[model samples]
Target chain A: DTAVSQTPKYLVTQMGNDKSIKCEQNLGHDTMYWYKQDSKKFLKIMFSYNNKELIINETVPNRFSPKSPDKAHLNLHINSLELGDSAVYFCASSADRGDGYTFGSGTRLTVV
Target chain B: AQSVSQHNHHVILSEAASLELGCNYSYGGTVNLFWYVQYPGQHLQLLLKYFSGDPLVKGIKGFEAEFIKSKFSFNLRKPSVQWSDTAEYFCAVSPWANNLFFGTGTRLTVIP
Candidate 1:
């Protein structure tokens, strides 16, 4: 079984539009995260949820929001998408603070 | 002000050549270190991680990393690299948080 999975592997939308990316993990981990990979391939942590509770929130724009319905599902919603939002979004999960880090395939978003 | 640093932005090596990637973090308290590889069109895979005990940690695909507390560094090493090993390597550091702080990453190109 796939440990972590993401929906819409590729997404292309125009500016000012809104989109959502769904993520699910079956690793039975308590913590889930959303990370962004820029063109330079630099990974940046966006948000983290522990047992459906918001634990880590980085200095991201207000347009981006993360929702965790449960420990196994975490979704990202972006409003007013801009060209700068064109990047690969990755979903990851860990057993704890830094144990058993597993990542999803990623969803590529292109805002034109 | 916690950050991870990967000095080698890009590296090129031939098949069967030894490989080493430098990773450093600037954090005061105890931290966990990790090495992750992202292959072409694939998700991030954990290479190795260092939480405690045995500074030397071995991971999958014959990859290993050593954590040096004094230097606040966790460097990854491999005796011999193959062409399939070409990927982007990222070093992450977590300090009592639910998320990970990733480095800029190093692109490794192993020529066959």
Candidate 2:
């Protein structure tokens, strides 16, 4: 079974458009996270949710928001996307803090 | 701020060549180290991880990593690589939770 999965493998949109990426995990993990991988392939954490509670919110713009309706699903929403928002977004899950991180197939966002 | 560092940005090797990728982190507290691999058109998968005890850890697909506490280094190695092993490798460090700080990934290509 696929442990973690994300929808919309590739996304191409106008600079000012809005978009959303959905992620789901069957691993029954409590903690889910969102990461952004830039052109340089540097991965940075954006947000983390544990059991429907927001645990970590990094130094990211307010344009990016994450929502977790439950423990098994986490989604990312971007509003008024800019050219700089073009990058790969990855969704990951873990049973607990720093334990067995599993990443989903990344969503490549292209703002043209 | 906690950060992970990967020395090699790109690596090219012929088939049957040994492989090594270096990773370092800047953190004084206990840490969990991980090596994740992303194959072409696939999600990032766990290659190996070191949480505690026994610094040397072996992962699937003939991959292994050794954690050096004093140097804060976790280097990955594979005895012989095949053409199919061509992928991007990322090194990550987490100090206290599942939220990770990743280094810029290393894109490795093995020529058959």
Candidate 3:
């Protein structure tokens, strides 16, 4: 079974449209995260939730919001996507603060 | 702010070549280090991690990493690499939080 799974493996949208990416993890982890990987392959953490509570929120713009309904799911919604929003969004989960995360196959978001 | 730095952005080698990728972090406190690999069209998978106890940690697929506290570095190494080892490797560090600070990945091309 895939420990971490993300929906919409690829997404292409217009500049003013909004989109959402869903993520789920069956690892029973307590912490879930959303990461953005740019064309240069630089991965940056955007948000993190611990047991459905927001714990880490980086300097990401308000256009991007992460919602975790429970410990198993974390979803990202982007409002009025722009050209700069074109990047791979990855979902990850970890059992604890000291454990390495299990990452899902990234969702490639391209804003035209 | 905590940051992770990967020295090598791209590397190419023939089969059976020894491999080493340098990773450095800018955090003085206790931290967790990890090396994650992303194969072509695949999700990111944990290669190795260092939390505490023995500084050297072994991981899947013949991968290993050493944590040097004095240098604030955790470098991944493999004695012999195969063609299947071609992937993008990411170094990440977490200091007292669930969020990871990732470095720009290193793309490895192992020629057959």
Instruction: List the DockQ of the predictions in order.
Output: 0.77, 0.77, 0.78
Expressed as tens digits, the lDDT of each residue in A42-99 for candidate 3 is 8888999997899888899999999888889999999999999999999998877557
- In candidate 2, stretches whose alpha carbon ends up further than 4 angstroms from where it belongs are none
Q: Name every residue pair that clashes in candidate 2.
A: A98-B97, A98-B98
Q: Encode model 2's per-residue lDDT on A14-100: one tens digit a residue.
A: 988989999999998989999998887778899999989889999999999999988899999999999999999999999775668
Misplaced by over 4 Å in model 3 are none
CA RMSD of all predictions: 1.1, 1.3, 1.3
Rank ordering of all candidates by TM-score, starting from the highest: 1, 3, 2
Clashes of each: 0, 2, 0
Candidate 1 residue pairs in clash (backbone atoms < 3 Å): none
Which residue pairs in candidate 3 have backbone atoms (N, alpha carbon, C) closer than 3 angstroms, thus clashing? Answer: none
Q: Which ten residues in a row have the lowest lDDT in candidate 3 chain B?
A: B93-102
lDDT of 3 by residue, B1-112 (tens): 6678898999999999999999999988888888989888778888988889999999999999999999998999999999999999999887876868888889999999
Candidate 3, after superposition: displacement of residue A97 in Å? Answer: 3.8
- Give the TM-score comparing model 3 with the true structure, all chains together: 0.95
Residue A102 alpha-carbon offset, candidate 3, angstroms = 0.9
**What's the lDDT for residue B15 in model 2?**
97
Candidate models: Cα lDDT each:
0.93, 0.91, 0.91
lDDT of 1 by residue, A9-66 (tens): 9999999999999999998998999999999999999999998888888899989999
